[model samples]
Target: MISLQEENDLIDQILGGKQEAYARLVDNYKSYAYTIALKILNNRPEAEEAAQDGFIKAYQYLKSFNRKARFSTWLYRIIFNTAISYKRKNRVQMESIEHNDRGEESRESDLERSDKEVFIARAMEHLNEADRLAIQLYYIKEFSLDEVAEMMGQRVNTLKVRVHRARQRLADELTKILKEEALTL
Candidate 1:
């Protein structure tokens, strides 16, 4: 991780016409940017494209970046917005299929895990976009609420409420699904 001082220096160099300095910033934040994009788009190719596009946009507007916020917070907001735009533009849904090969004992465990994942995913579908994004960022990605709120452009309290409500909805949905499955069995 780059120190805030080092990050500021790099920004200074980039603004002073040292293009290579920007590469360091991209390298430092690319994974995070890609992860954000992936969470939003749920497609590898689209996420990669969105992350790259976000970096380009950041660079294009680098001159206008005020020093009030950490560079990452600002960049992530841009990446989040870019990924959301991509999601809006590409409305097609793609489902991923996974195949697991393991020892017999592990196979059963994997199957259980996979089943739970399916249930959770199905529950997630019932959430509004903001609630879903809040849950994913806060729980799955392990971002602090402050960071998630900043990246999502919401007040911290608003994000907390969304996360809480999302969790409640997910739990209710999962319970309903599990009970239905139990009856079928």
Candidate 2:
């Protein structure tokens, strides 16, 4: 992670006609931006496009970025908004395909973990979009509550409540799912 001073210097260089400085910023934030987009769009291709578009938009609007907030927070907000827009525009639901390339060393444990992941994913599907986003940003992405709130454009307290409620709902759903699975065993 770049220090705040370094980030500011890069922003200054970008604003002063040193366009290459922007690449550093993009490199620093691209994975995070793509993750945010993936969380929203759930499609790898669309998420990648949205992250790129967000970077372009950020570059275009860089001059207007007041130094009040961290550049990352600002850039992530742009990424989040861009991804949301893409999600709205593409209303068609697409399932994400993930490839597992683990060797045979831990197949049994991997299967157990995969089963748990499927159950948790099913429980996550029960959450409303906002709650799901809030929880994912706060927990899965390991963003601070304040950062997640700012990115989501919600008050910190509101986001905290959303996260709490979402966790409760997930727990309930998981328990129900486990019970059903147990009955079938």
Candidate 3:
């Protein structure tokens, strides 16, 4: 993790005409940005595009960034919003597990992995975007609740409620999916 002082120095350097300093920020946050984009866009190519565009946007608006928030939180908000915009403009179709008709063409391990992925994806689909993002930011990305709240522009108490409800919704969805799978078998 980049120290706060180091990040502040880099920000200052970037603001002072040192464009290369921005690359360090990108290096630090790109994976998380990509993950955020991927979860929202659900398409690798579009997610990559969104994440790159987010980094570009962040650099363009670097001078306006408020110092009170952690840089990762700020960058994450940009990436998340950019991905949502991309999703809106493109209206990408959600890839359903039903589309995987590859019967016996796959190996057992691959099938199991694909099934788990499908299960999680389908479960996530049941959630509203905010709830889904809250869960991802808190659990999958392992951000602190306080950080997630900041990124989401919500109070910590509100965020706790949101996360709890989102988890319950996910669990319900997973149970439903499991029942459907059992019936098929």
* TM-score, every prediction: 0.81, 0.87, 0.80
Query: Model 3 residue 102 lDDT?
Result: 28
Please say which candidate is ahead in lDDT: 2 or 3: 2
Q: What is the lDDT of residue 128 in candidate 3?
A: 89
Point to the candidate with the largest lDDT. 2
Candidate 2 matches the true fold with a TM-score of: 0.87
| Candidate 3 ranges beyond 4 A from true positions | 92-115
lDDT (10s digit) by residue, model 1, range 139-179: 74557899999999999999999999999999999999999
Please write out the lDDT profile of model 3 over residues 91-135, one tens digit for every residue: 634333324632332344346677877787679878988888888
Clash count per candidate: 0, 0, 0
In candidate 2, what are the lDDT values of residues 1-185, reduced to their tens digit? 89999999999999999999999999999999999998897767889999999999999999999899888889999999999999877664322222232233235445767888878877998999999999988874568999999999999999999999999999999999999999999
Error of 3 at 123 (Å): 2.0
Give every collision pair in model 3. none
lDDT (Cα, 0-100) at 176 in candidate 2? 100
